[model samples]
Target: MSKKVTGNAFDAKIFKRLMGFAARYKWQFIVSTISAILMSIVSVAKPILLQKIVMIYFENKDKEGLLNYSLLMILFLLAEVILQFLFIYIVNWMGQHIIKDIRIQLQKHMLQFKMSYFDNSSVGKLVTRLVSDTETIAQFFGQGLFMIISDLLKMFVVAIVMLWMNWKLAFIAFIILPILIYATKLFQIAIKSAFQEVRIQVANLNGFVQERVTGMNIVQLFNREKIEYENFIKINNKHKKAHVRTVWYYSIFFPIAEILSSIAVGLLVWYGSLDIVNEGITDAGQIIAFIMMSQMLFRPLRQIADKFNTLQMGMVAGDRVFEVLDTHSQIDKTGKVEAKDFKGNIAFKNVHFSYIEGEEVLKGISFNVNAGETVAIVGATGAGKSTIINLINRFYEINEGEICVDNQNIKQYTLKSLRKKIAVVLQDVFLFSDSIFNNIILSNETITLDEVKNAAKEIGIHEFIMSLPNNYHYNVKERGAMLSSGQRQLIAFLRAYVSKPSILILDEATSSIDSYSEKLIQQATDKITRHQTSIIIAHRLTTVKKADKIIVMDKGRIVEQGSHLELLHKNGYYKNLYDMQFASEVA
Candidate 1:
């Protein structure tokens, strides 16, 4: 999923919020500012003292003043070293703290987003957004903040010293300033383009690898090892090309900046030498001092040039992360109004829904399930059996009409209050990479070990868990790859039933369990569904035979609905469904 890049290009205004992100640890930034300023002051003093030592001490033989100036220069050098260290440390502290907050906030925001957000979003893109992209942005502010502040300080101090010591020489050097600025600006553009290319390629590479790693089982099952290997190489080649382009740009700019700085120094020395020869005024030390100062000025000019590339990459990544954080989910519970209790009465009134434009998946569907009744939705593949369950639970908002629970419109109730009473087990079960106990708990409050064991026993997987070396402590790998399909489904069943919801939706929940486990779960289901509103979407007709009401759906519409024996007598859609699964019907 390639997100359209909308990086706020080198905008000074965007950085205002960037500053706000750092405000949480602004004291560290203050310390960094002080350290950087002090360092700049000490650095600029040395060349002035050198010129004085040459003109007064060496030429006029003033021993006392020379020694004092030399001692002061040494002291300034020491101060510069200590302050530079402090500056680096403080800015780093500030940068790292801001990164931590941004990452945590990004995850929290991701959690609050609607389910559709994940449906359209890619896991690999999000991983890159959270990990590599966050790191790059953090480093940009960390190192880039120091470079900006420290260099601006050095430039200011250098300009002042240049004017005070020898205004004429300073004027000669400043003549080339416009040309250098133009060159750096153009070079920064080149590097920015290069960095953007690198960022895009890196994001693509991450996505490719993440998808492949996630679908490893599918790859092995189909015997597509060579195809997978080729896919990896294709992305690797793209990354290499991008990296080479970045390095190529860097190589050119570094040398060009160096040559320009040297030419400016050479011109200043050429002009300053003529004045010294004509008046016999300037000494060797002043020329050396001039060279040192020129180099000092260009050093940070070069750093800003290099760091601009990093800044560009960071901006690209920061924009991606902010997109997720800035989005407001379609479902929000901010109204402060809520349904106090859900008695399991679900009412759908003229509900119309569609997953795509110009095509209705559920059309003007109206139905009512009274409290504590068992409702089974039966349908062909394209029929809206799952869609109806989805609408009742308010997973997908209705396009037209309203759904009510316990006599109140669902939209008026807090989403938490609306969903707290519902538990759904989809055909595909997802388990986290945690212990079996935690997976059973499934983001709800932790349950007692006894409750976990009992839920497992109800699903008929308890004795099997104890048979393993870790039992309840057994580690379930990603999606429960370490366990069998039957084991995974049984565990997912416990996760749903243990919540004790007022309403239960089992969409082919027992599809994977063995005959023995199915028998056990059927027994437990009878007691659990006694007074709870149950909606079961069955593939095996016999599993839902005892449901109080059965509704048959076709082509996004309900074709027929009645009690099991009543539907069978009608010999309609449900009758054909029963005939199709005859073996399971009589099992």
Candidate 2:
């Protein structure tokens, strides 16, 4: 299903939620609002002062009276300037604070999202919400909202003043109000749809760019750079088109506003001349003041429309952000039991599971591992080997099974405590862009540098680490790209070793390791698995040779279970797997 780009116009629920963040600094916003109100009043007073000087003081031939009024006008101008600066600083400060709070809250909420949500969602789209959308919302608080309120108030005050000065001239000046209002309404509706399109295109462009950059190596390796570049240009053009539509609406609206404004001025001159010819109804100063007042009234009417667009854009962003915040897809962490001293006697009873419904991966499978025993699961690809590891770690909940550790249901233990008792080393290891030491210890205050070094030395990887520049402090770059595959595997092994968990999981850890590294890994594995419950999923089969028990699986069911030598004698699935590997190696 395609997603809608725009939210409800003037969504009170979203507006109230956004205001909740601004309310943290209510005193500052209140002070800025009061300043805006005063500025509007001061702005309206200037036209009156201009009228008094022209008619009452300038025409009287009194230089002293003119000088006094001029001084008062200067004071008002200076006061307006000071208040503008004050409000500008305060409003911007409050905006920054509110967005800072919002970004932090959004990040915290994202951290709680389920793994499944991330599995299907785009990282680039989420980034747009965190960075661009939140920034747009910031403009609403800093500039759009306050300017809109000030403009509306100025128009109101100017309207009253114009009527008081000369009701007939005000009537002639406001004759174009109906047309102006209709044009503005149409502009608002058109611009809103355009802004929504712009936002949607921006998100799509960001997603494309982020994914392409991250995987540029693969694109170049496959020699598909030209095709990818063409795809990017297509997306870029769509984004450009969305923005151009917005400009098109702006072009139409502003010219109409200017024409109406000029007509109002022309009407004032044309009608005021009749008043002068009919009788001495209005003076020159009042006529001039009426012109200035018309500008004050009509210009803000246009500005109010523009500022309302800013507000609408902010609401669109707020709707997107709040949708993520309101999602309730987090895993249930209600288990109260704490596995303080986990013995790791693992068992899976009648486990049936699937990544998708009605397509079972581990169907009616049962297995058991005694404390301190090592078990190896061997199978062809997609034969539920890795799925077993995932279920044991509870990365996904089983459809119909009870997985237990230490003779109690695994779900009975608190997730934090349960995971702390186990460590996993996958063949495709991932490391953060940090120092090797930090990657191994992972900021666990309890594991010091010395302990990490001791673990590395015991695992026989200390010499390899020391060979790098800066030794243990060497940066591994992103995803450990600086290291060889074997070196990264060794690092993963050492990382798991430092945790000192009761259960160790090695999912094809030696599949990509070189022969020399494999020897060291085998030695480390033998030592580590001696007194812990270990589960090894292997395709090479050689790595599982020394395992106390081997469970052979095919199509999500265990077909054979025995020692390495006994499995070879059975002349079954394990024997066929062994013979196939031996024949390929001999050839």
Give me the candidate number with maximum lDDT.
Answer: 2
TM-score, every prediction: 0.90, 0.89
- The residue-by-residue lDDT of candidate 2 on 497-581, one tens digit each, is 9999999999999999898898788888988999999999876556677789999999988999999899988899999988877
Give model 2's TM-score versus the native structure.
0.89
Please give the lDDT score at residue 532 for candidate 1: 86
Q: Cα lDDT of model 2 overall?
A: 0.86
Candidate 1 local lDDT, 1-587, one digit each (tens): 55444332475645666677888887787888888888888888888778777877658898898888889888888888899888887777777887788899888888777666777887777887888778877876877756676897898789778777677777776776777777778777776666677777987887778778879999999998899899889989989998998788778777888888888789778877887888755566677677778888887887786776666666766777787777876665564556555688988898888877689998888888999999988888889888887776666777899888887788777887767778888878898899888888866675688998877776666898898769888888888889877778777778778888888888887777778767766776786888889989887666567889987888887788889889889978878888886545584
